[model samples]
Target: MKKLLVIYWTFFKMGAVCFGGGYAMLPILERELVKKRGWTTKENLIDYYAIGQCTPGVIAVNTSTFVGNEIGGIFGGIMGTLGFITPSIIIITLIAALLSNFAHIDMVQRAFGGIRICVCALMFMAVAKLWKSAVKDMLGTVIFIMVAGCSVFLDISPVIYVILAATVGIIADKIKSTSKE
Candidate 1:
């Protein structure tokens, strides 16, 4: 129970301050859970983030549930999810109440415009970080470029890029197998 409460409080604080959506939460999660608390390792956090991305619901919520469960069990998962979402609930409610009036305010509008830019920057940073981590060699670089090209030039879905990458991987493996045999 006490452990669950700690999990709840920690994620609640994270949720309250995390801006620019799910990817933006990663650095904070690393700092809080991995660095400060030593609750998890960097590798564990990265693996959980990857898994969280593939799961249903929001990534942040999924990650909170995963980490919380890993730390405190089912009850911890419940607390973590609730904690992470609590900030969104409160903020959205407040925004919903004030949006109509605030929308007309020039300063608020400007602030939001700046925030949108910042969110884009954050997303770009996440992409760069992931690229550095995932792209290991020339083959990996080629795959990255090909995927980017397909997405940008052909307007291909990311799922198609993933499929193509898997196909390439299989073909490469078969070529190596044939050479060995």
Candidate 2:
């Protein structure tokens, strides 16, 4: 019960201040779950992040659910999800009411422009950190480099990239399996 409360509060704080969407919450989630609370290890968190990315819905909420489920089960998943989303729901509702006025303000627009840049930076930092932890060995490095190139230059869909990577992973494993025999 006490542990569940902690999970709820940690994710609630994350969801509250998280801007720039799901990826932006990675650093905060890591800090809360790994550094502050010691609830999960770095490797486990990275795995959860990767899984969260591939799953439906927002990455932050998915991650919170995974973490919660890991710690406390179904009830934990519910609390964690609620904790992760409550802020966005409330903020968006409030913003919807004030959006017209806010949009008309020149200062607000300028501030939003700056915030967008900072948000991108934060997301990039999270991606870099996660990449460093997730990618291991030459094969993994090659996949990273190729996918990154394709993502940037080829203008291919992300779904295609994920499929390609998975195909390559399967082929590589098959080769490894045959070699050992």
Candidate 3:
């Protein structure tokens, strides 16, 4: 029970401040779950983030559920998901109620503009961290460049890239194993 509560509280705090979606949450996840809590490793968190992106629903919520389940089973997953979404629910409701009144205010618009800038900074940090962790080998660098280029210049589904990447990784691993024998 205590463990579950702690998980819920931890995710709740994450949810409250995780602006600009899942990428923006990466630093916080690294700090709280990987560095501070000792609950999971940075690699595992990145795996969770990747899987979360592929799965249905919000990435942060999905990642939290995966971590929570790892910590305390199914119930923990439920608690973590609830905790992560509760803040958004409350905040959205309040904003819906009050946004119309303040939407026209110059100060509110400027605040939003500032928040967008901050979110961009957060996302850049997250990308740098991901690059350091993920782009280690030549193969990884090649894949990164190809995907980045395609994503920038083409109008293709991201799912295709993910599928191709996974397929390439599996085939590369198999070939590498065969060459060693």
Candidate 4:
């Protein structure tokens, strides 16, 4: 019961402040869940983020579900997702009521612009952290370069990139195993 409440409260705080979605939530999650709460480690959260990306929902929500499930069970998953989305529901509702009146305010526009910049900074920080752990070898570097190039230069789905990377990793592992044998 206490653990479940903690899960809800922690995720509620994260969801409330995690402005730009999954990538933006990484640093907060690392600090709140990993460092403070001891709910998960950096690598585990990254793995959850990866899985969330490839799954069929919003990445932040998916991650919340995964972490919650890990902490408790189905009920935890429910609680986590509820905690994460509750803020959005309330804030969006309030914003929807108030935004029409404030949409033309220069101050509001400037605030939004500042928010966009902050979100970008948060995402960049996340990418840097992820890069340190994800790009550990020659194969990883090659995959990262190829994916980064394609993502920048092409209009392909990221799913394609993930599939290609997974296939490459599998083939490479098989080759190494055969050589060892």
Say which candidate scores most in TM-score. Answer: 3
Worst 10 residues of 3 by lDDT: 16-25
lDDT by residue for model 4 (1-181), tens: 9988988988899998998785767898899988998887889999999998778879999999999998889989989999999999999999898998898999999999999999999889888987886799998999889889889999999999888888999999999999999
Q: Point to the candidate with the largest lDDT.
A: 3
RMSD of each: 4.6, 5.4, 5.4, 5.4
Instruction: Tally clashing residue pairs in candidate 3.
Output: 0
Positional deviation of residue 83's Cα in model 3 after best superposition, in angstroms: 3.2
Residue by residue across 82-136, what tens digits does model 2's lDDT show? 9888888899889888977678799989998999999999889888888877798
Pairwise lDDT winner, candidates 2 and 4: 4
Off by over 4 Å in 1: 101-181
Candidate closer to the true structure by TM-score (higher is better), 2 or 4:
4
Ranking by TM-score: 3, 4, 1, 2
| RMSD (Cα, Å) of model 2 | 5.4
TM-scores for all predictions:
0.59, 0.59, 0.62, 0.60
**lDDT at position 74, candidate 1:** 95
Q: Please report the TM-score between candidate 3 and the true structure.
A: 0.62
Off by over 4 Å in 3: 1-76
